[model samples]
Target: MRAADWSTPRLGLSELPVIEVPNHALAFGWSSKSGPIRRRVDDCPVASRDGPVRRQRARWAEDRRSDDAIATLIVPIEVGIGLRRRPIDDVNAWLDTDVATHLEG
Candidate 1:
């Protein structure tokens, strides 16, 4: 199997940090002021790079299946070891319908 490219706008979350089983995916639970949510991704999408440490902004948008609209957006303003939380300002900043899409499949 091959890893998915991460250098494109289609990429959302950061590189996952854990052991992965081939052909399987994982989802992590996150909390916010509204309630709790989950972020799911296939593990075969992270790319490897070298050199000095670099930082990348990781943002998440949740689109409700009912109304086909985004209900929550989370952006972590601060990060720590195994813990991350987004401030209200950051959430508001990145929350928008910039990527809304409709597909006929």
Candidate 2:
């Protein structure tokens, strides 16, 4: 994760370095201010990003679902991935909805 992308609340405690699990991590116990909590990541997808993920992921997300001749990011901030923590096809829609056109003066 990049500097700007990381914004998780900080937790202070003795921690072990991140290591590859033998098979999979069932759960990790952690002591918090409230109490002890267990972490369960059932469908965590770990990917190796070569470059800036935002621009790349945005384009790739649309391409994966769009069938149109051309796909572009008209309104970058408004349209984005889905609620399920995966890329959604919000970029490539019908021409009318995708972009706004005005007649020349």
Candidate 3:
């Protein structure tokens, strides 16, 4: 349950200033107590890319993260029960939740 707010990105042709490209950057959100909370985090533009390619991006991104999360979940669970419930690689879930909410609203 961690996240970071990155500065927006600027995209355009050198000469043209009419069209605005949304941010298309990824970022990491971290905290000392909770390690590796999420990844493939998006900047403002990248997040907004959902407008057109939202479903595709989310499907692919979430599948990737779910695979990673499952891999990581194994080690921690095998180690001990204390770490079994810990959250790991949750960016996909976070993204899905956000996108769903946005679409609903």
Candidate 4:
């Protein structure tokens, strides 16, 4: 199947992170090709002053059906790269100094 078919709305990436999937989930150990593959994307939550509403008020019925159909059944694999140090600290430090004069105001 084409990667586009598996594209998840919540996930911005163009391709599925299949590499992150665990081998144990596969019927066989690990093979370049083989075994069942599934993909899904959930609805984005609505954040408002009212405080974290679980349901979307607009097109509620239609959205529920679409959300349910999308979440039917699928195995997922999470893949991420670990950083030796947090990047945010360095970024904040840099921006806090002369580099980001706009924020000083």
Candidate 5:
């Protein structure tokens, strides 16, 4: 689906400030070795495997160039080994145990 092009968006008066229009956003927290990492393969072919030089970055900010109030939604989940539905408690425990051993599994 796409935005309807039937009418033009009017930037007129409003109670909410323009900068506060989009006062929300989401940010995904991936491992540093995954993303937000510099493409410095030249510096070290296996720079990613050379221990964590940079920690996992799950940060958010309002870019000085834009008025969008981006908000970060970071949630911690368990890292089980097997493919099985983990219990709600286990999922939020942040454990790295095998899912198969779980009672629910």
Candidate 6:
């Protein structure tokens, strides 16, 4: 994650890393400050060059009874993926929200 000051907290964890997970990583575990958390990811579809990436994780809650176990989707802001230019506030906002959202899932 990029370093930031006390002004903006939402953009503090942006541009963390460009990890390339293996195709076989169906269930992955990572350690956090609290404890270890395991995530089972079914699919990660890249949105069009227009919204954010659709990162979905599997839900293991007891109330989840649907055939699909996918959790809520989180759209992360990612730079250095498309055309490069001066990244002003407007550009960063667009890239984070409206840049890529048309790819076929």
TM-scores for all predictions:
0.21, 0.17, 0.20, 0.19, 0.19, 0.18
Give one digit per residue, the lDDT tens place, for model 5 in 1-105. 111111112211132111112223333634434323323221211101112222342332113113442222223333333212333233323223432233233
Off by over 4 Å in 1: 1-67, 81-86, 92-105
Q: Rate the local accuracy (lDDT) of all candidates.
A: 0.28, 0.27, 0.28, 0.30, 0.25, 0.29
Residue 21 of model 2: what lDDT? 28
Least accurate stretch of 10 residues (summed lDDT) in model 6?
A: 30-39
Weakest 10 consecutive residues of candidate 3 by summed lDDT: 1-10
Estimate the Cα RMSD of every predicted model relative to the unseen true structure. 16.1, 17.5, 17.5, 18.1, 20.1, 12.1
Query: CA lDDT of 87 in candidate 3?
Result: 24
**Per-residue CA lDDT of candidate 6, range 1-105, in tens?**
222222133334434223333433223442131111123222322211212332222232211324443222232345445322322344345446532352123
What is the Cα-based lDDT of residue 55 in candidate 1? 30
Let me know the TM-score candidate 2 reaches against the reference structure.
Answer: 0.17
Go through the candidates in order and give the clash count of each.
0, 0, 3, 0, 0, 5
User: What local lDDT score does residue 22 receive in model 5, on the 0 to 100 scale?
Assistant: 26
TM-score of 1: 0.21
lDDT of 1 by residue, 50-105 (tens): 21222321232322422444333333322233212223334223433332222111
Considering every candidate listed, which one attains the maximal lDDT? Answer: 4
Stretches > 4 Å off in candidate 6 = 1-8, 11-66, 81-105
lDDT of 2 by residue, 20-103 (tens): 224432233311211111122112211121222344345543563374423233233322431222122232232235233311
**What stretches of model 5 exceed 4 Å from their correct place?**
1-55, 60-68, 81-105
Ranking by lDDT: 4, 6, 3, 1, 2, 5
